[model samples]
Target: MQTCKILQDISALQVLSINISRRCFYTTTTTSPLPWLFVGLGNPGEKYQGTRHNVGFDMIDVLAKSHGISMDRVHCKAIFGQGLISDVPVFLAKPQTYMNLSGESAGPLAAYYKLPLSRIVAFFDDMNLPCGVLRLQDKGGNGRHKGVRSLIHHFRGNSEFARLRIGIGRPPGQMDPKAFLLQKFNATARERIDVGLQEGVGALKLLASRGLTESARCFNKEQKYKHIRVQTLET
Candidate 1:
């Protein structure tokens, strides 16, 4: 899909050389707030659709719904909603390039906009946290995620961007991590995913408007749904 004309003034049009080549993706002719990019990491194609690893995409979908945003048909990209969060234009994207190569789509988009690494927020699934839990961090190591690793590589190992991680639970004993991520969410786990999705949506908005630290503080207290811990008397 082509970019909207509003985005042209931001250097994306020049980066793609649309004027000289006449080959443009989309054109938006509107003014907007400082452009911020949101990348939801996941594998491409129907086969991986709705899988646990696609929680990032799923969360973005929820965010769109909450804000009345719609996805526009862009070439090789699932993009939609050029609207305001705190009156700032935010671009939402789910890379069709699939996980592991997410940077292939996001890296260029970031460069084209001349956006600081700090302005990019990557939403993705995390196995370390318990199901229904959410965490927002400024930056960190990939922690065994190939997709994140690829993004880090494309950005030349800069982890200064914000990350919103949604827990997808861990694999059962002896199960392959890749296989598990590709698996659909179990019936019992659906509730947690729903709750996490809601929290993720809220966190995304807060992150976009307020900043990462504020969002992190708001979401860090969401562990109540994961499980309740109690003290016991020792004999």
Candidate 2:
């Protein structure tokens, strides 16, 4: 698994060098408030559903359901919906270029919408934390996540985009991370995972309305999801 991650990092660097011109022109004019782009990374296809790696897509579904955003339109190599979440206009995107090439979709979508990297959120699963936990950050490196690596690569190594990482926990001893990521959540962990997903949606909503500091406080403290209490939570 570690070897695979290293290879992915090398591959990303190579791709980043060639895709340096992914940035697009932007217009200064605007009538409405700037929109937010929430990107959920996952491989396309029903076979991938319910897998650890696809948790981002699962929560994106939760967000879209809560906001009444229909994600039927395809654009910029992703399926997305534009609508308001907590009265904040937002776009929820699921990239179809698979996991490692997420930026092939996300980068262009952000460019087309003229949304700055600061307002974009990358939601994905994290093995660094235990299940039933979450970590919301204003910005940071992707660690070893190739999907995020791809985004950073396309953004010219800029990790300024916000990220919401749902803790799926590391694979059990001696397991390959790739196999672990592709496995479906079993009954044993389902409850905790579901709870974490719910809390993640709340954290994401707060991020859209209340800003990163508060959202991080609500999501990323050492206590994690089990004990933290957040006020005025809606989205």
Candidate 3:
């Protein structure tokens, strides 16, 4: 009887091993594509429309219009839209939680989608670059931007997600930074921003078609060259 008991235990172990192997196989063979989440950080409402701080929202609008994606859904505290770009699934969001609390919307949307941090990209304004200049980086800390700081906090201090910085330039000569952000662009600035938005759309299309790394590499190189020329001309 003892010998029979030992044999039964061995048989159970074999069954468990088979089940584990099958589970591994299933996991390894699954090939469903994960969608990319593109979040634009900005304050909601018409009060902030066309302000320097709302350029991120402008980007989302341009992208939606270009792709025919309707921004009619509210999800995770954001105006959300989803569509296919070159057969790649894409989700666009403009956080309605305002600029400072943008994470309240972005973080939950990422969690709800179950996307890896690598597949998430945020667009927001930056004062460090020249007006209408843009930069795309894989990951970085918040560059004194409250919206970015909030996102970092909600991401549990994980700054591994991607971001595209839309430059609004530094506040002019002692001008209050906050006031500068809320101000509408002048005609010249508006023209530059419009051009920047068009370039941004092209970069995003490349991102959807190729990927973050390749898109960032190509886009940043062109932007850097353009920036150098602008600086040379200014000086």
Best by lDDT: 3
Worst 10 residues of 1 by lDDT: 226-235
For candidate 1, give the lDDT.
0.76
Instruction: Please give, for residues 9-63, the per-residue lDDT of candidate 2 as tens digits.
Output: 9999988755653532222334445678999998899899999999888889988
Off by over 4 Å in 3: 1-29
Counted clashes in each candidate structure: 14, 0, 0
Query: Using Cα atoms with residue i matched to residue i, what is each candidate's TM-score against the true structure?
Result: 0.79, 0.80, 0.86
List of clashing residue pairs for candidate 3: none
The 10-residue segment with the lowest total lDDT in model 2: 226-235
Evaluate all candidate structures by whole-model CA lDDT and list the values in order. 0.76, 0.83, 0.89
Error of 3 at 65 (Å): 0.7
| Candidate 3 local lDDT, 20-58, one digit each (tens) | 666551233346356789899898888999999999999
Candidate whose TM-score is highest: 3
- The list of candidate 2 runs beyond 4 A from truth reads 1-32, 222-235
Q: What's model 3's TM-score?
A: 0.86
**Candidate 1, superposed: residue stretches over 4 Å from native:** 1-33, 75-80, 224-235
Whole-model alpha-carbon lDDT for candidate 2: 0.83
